[model samples]
Target: MGQSTTPVLDRVGFAMLSIIMISVLVTASSVFGTSSNPKGVSIPLQERGSPLAKDGVIIPEALARLAYWDAAKQHAKINNSGPPNNSSSLFRRHSAPLESKLDDILWVGEIEIGKPRQRFRVDFDTGSSDTWVFSSTCVAPICSSKNKYIASESSTSTLQVGEFKKDYFDGTEVSGPIYADTITVAGLSAEGQWFSPIDQVNNMEDYGRDGLMGLSFMSISQLKAPTFIGTLLSQKKISKHIFSMRLSSGSGSELFIGGINPSKYRGELTYVPLESQTMWIVKGSASANGRNGFNGNMVIDSGTWV
Candidate 1:
């Protein structure tokens, strides 16, 4: 959300400082109610990246970042939704590690679906409100190396009447049929969760993860169904409607579901009220390394490095 005309700081440095400062600014906000003590689920994050080039050359950070921003912007245009209601109640905690790729540009974590539990790694994106993954019907070259969800294999899988398609800024798309099944993340299960089972991938190359788990509000969801987190809240799977992510250069990153880990962060938590509910939009000013900065509405997006 904060940018500098001069190259005041690199991406990683700026990201770290922003995260910490934001945490301090929005820690005790009413969004995370003060009614009850919230338990934290700490998931460790892993580091990963796209496949090497034909000549075994890694992609440059600037180019990779550009691609990410394009995708994030495309997602932003999807829709607008209101903020979710949050209640601070006790709930069980589940923890897992996330995978970080390309100099902490991409953060992915494991999730399981179906009765028998087909596992896959997904990028938990907050910029979008749709959760989608490759399906067994997908025969695209891009999906050949990723895990595909097989509806027939899961007795709990129900075919929903609808099609799902997402267009990116680059004109590439990933789409498929919708399904409602049991989705498990970090040991917490949300039954009858509706998500797109991607069977068609057009010009959309792999991004080191099987699919994406959108953590934003459901109003932007393409399926018109509750987002995974929303489903969990409605189903009473997690009493607290709170989750947080800690990103870094590589490794040591984590996704805290259900609540925030007090151990991971110290000092009094500051709560910055949201300016808008559609996304994590907050009005705040940012500075780089004690230099001059700008003030405006900032979208706290984890889907891309802005």
Candidate 2:
């Protein structure tokens, strides 16, 4: 035989996970890449006084935003803000006075969807009952206008955006739905989490995103049949009796999918039965707020007030 070549078979599935570190995630950690800089901030000046330079000067607004973005990124890297293989690497808490380790908040890495859009991370919410993105259909001037629905890629596991109706326009609550679209984050796929399903006619850009993937451990996001926690349970990823939220502000909050580190908290976590209407509201006294200030019924979230 002159030459024999065997075709090799590859078996690993390709999961394209887009991790978007929210500006809020900038609360802690310091890892990053230069590619992350905004094009406005990175634009090189041919000469100091070029017309694009605005009187031989850098744009103050751009500079300030860049500075803030940079700081947030750096904070995350320093704190090792990311998922853990085990439970040990999840958080480095800070309990002060009586216990500053009390203020440890958990952070989830979010993915920025679509180009030239307002970027936001998806939180696993259990407190709220709606899922939305900074989409075009959102008429509130405060909402991000650059958001868009992403559907060009093949989704082995992905979100499906649905019909939209306008919510507001010109400071008036008009009739437009938030709509639907697919969104994925952290290599975890929760399909149909997005909103807004209309094709572009007026302005596809008008509907910023299909919508955001709100995957709060609490019951905040609105789903018809399967709540986020309910889905997690169906997948056998967690227990029906217990699921935890370690909402991060910037430094320490994190989301625990299955269980909390026994050593991380002092007393056991007291979880209230989540009502479909309000979501999982973990209750703690004011002292818990002073210490952890996280995971409370009626007023808890992944990102902290800090």
Best candidate, lDDT: 1
lDDT (CA) per prediction: 0.61, 0.29
For candidate 2, write residues 77-148 as lDDT tens digits.
223242223332122211111011222222323443332222443423322334544434444543444343
Pick the TM-score winner.
1
Q: What lDDT is obtained when candidate 1 is compared to the true structure?
A: 0.61
Angstrom error at residue 38, model 2: 39
Candidate 2 residue-wise lDDT at 151: 41
Find the 10 residues in a row with the least total lDDT in model 2: 41-50
lDDT of 1 by residue, 78-170 (tens): 334221122111111111113534333456788999999999998877767788989888898878898989999999999989899876443
Candidate 2 achieves a global lDDT of 0.29
Instruction: TM-score for candidate 2, please give it.
Output: 0.39
